[model samples]
Target: MNEDSTPQSSTEPARPSSGWDRELLEKLLLEALVEQRKARRWSLAFRVFLVAAIGLGFILAFKPLAQGGLTAPSKAHTAVVDVIGTIAEGGEIDADTIIEGLREAAEAKGVKGIVLRMNTPGGSPVQSAYVYDEIRRIKKEHPALPIYAVVSDLCASGGYYIASATDRIFVNPASIVGSIGVIMNGFGFVGTLEKLGVERRVMTAGDHKAILDPFGPVDPAEKQHVQQLLNAVHQQFIAAVKAGRGDRLKDRPEIFSGLVWTGAEGIELGLVDAVGELHQVAETVIGAKEIVNYSHRETLLDRVIRQLGTSVETALTKLATSSPRL
Candidate 1:
């Protein structure tokens, strides 16, 4: 057989040993390593970003955690106890809440005095009286600690009743004060029910169980009883004012006739000690240059929860407003 035509020996290889194969393998290995490094870096970055996001979420969830110790110190020598909104039971400015705040302020080591910030249209007489008593007790216990009441916008009725227990009352010139009286409000639906031929089947074991029921006719005896109770509350209110204001209060029945007066008139009538705002009382009257708020600060999470509750309340209010009156 010719040399070129004969098949190569089976044991001998005919392929060429080119360097391109080795070079290609090296390039693939390097590319793989680079890809691995990039993947590792991406994973690390993702982990870092995840941790940061979680931390931010926690901070947002618990705002108070971020504001740690902010409200720990009592501001200045004077602690402020804000009495905003209505002075009704179960309210933020109710007797229980105010009393607790006052007690805390009184017990705080840094607080030398208390400033009762009053801004309310007033509410339940019973609740107001409870707060008044608590204030008086605190005053008696801490005779040296001065308690000044600073009235804003409107401080009438029960609000004034509470202010009466303070050592001194300061009000802005346009602020409304006074209204030393008791009032109970309820609708009477007896006539309406009768006209509509609707019978109320309310039953009680006691004769006075339904004394103030709107669907029933108001008994003369019940009316007298309620009046007497209100009158008693009014007398207690008068006594508190007399004790606080002493000889300063003018001897006028009109003062206790549920008559609201401006701050200018109140000062003249001794219903208020002076006319001033909160800043004036804090800076000039109390002579405190720095203020530290000791009021309970809601955490970020708590504020969110409170906001949700307020939203619910607003919805309920809207629903009630839209509904037909009974």
Candidate 2:
């Protein structure tokens, strides 16, 4: 008989194929159970991690208390508020933040005096005015509490406007101080465009709408109007200075002529009261001589979000507000 043609047995049951063998099945079941347990543990761990991260973020966002929560004072320490940076919206130093810090100092227990550690080359006139108003308001509310402006570097223009509201201003000998002036400055590319054979297409509904368009010829009438506007603001600045400084300011022609002077000259010119440092001023103001900062600091995440919003708003308003610097 050919082996290829041989038939299989009929009565003998064929051995079952490998399906769900007891040992193999048991092994697989054990592995699956173990994997499920591990998966559950990992899921629980991930959930726990998320919860912890969220709680931490919340603490960071709202940790500083209402009354100088950043630091607790032991005695009647000199509460210091920093006005360090350009006095403008969206900067480290601004009306809102400065006022917030001032409020904190006002509310803080046993705060002897408030020191404004100012360092700025000036910025937005409106922003500076806001801060100045707040300072005056605070001073009015807390007449007994002394507020001092201690300049570190360039305390010019708007910086001076804010400082003028303080009880007294102390500056380092070489510090640049004073710029009690308002200015409007921008560039005109009309001549360049004309030479380049380019025509600027502009349309406005109002006569003075396109007043200082950089790409077009500057209208003399518009220029005069803008100068008058600057002079008005300058007058306001001068009034603020006079109101704040009172009779301390010397009657000098160059005092408010947009000229900056050294701290030593500022004293002679009566733009500044005295020459001193933070520690010395603190010691002079408060009995304890211990100083505590009460500045409103933006968190890292908060700053990023603020900048994003500000950048978008500025981009939208840039063309509309192409006027001078403040």
Q: Kindly report the root-mean-square deviation of model 1 from the true structure over all alpha carbons.
A: 15.5
- Pairs in clash, predicted candidate 1: 63-300, 64-300, 75-292
Per-model C-alpha lDDT, please?
A: 0.79, 0.83
Segments in model 1 whose C-alpha atoms lie over 4 Å from true places? 1-69, 72-76, 297-326
Whose TM-score is greatest here? 2
lDDT of 1 by residue, 14-61 (tens): 787689988998888888877776676566556655655665576566
Candidate 2 residues lying further than 4 Å off, grouped into runs, are 1-57, 60-70, 301-326
Clashing pairs in 2: none
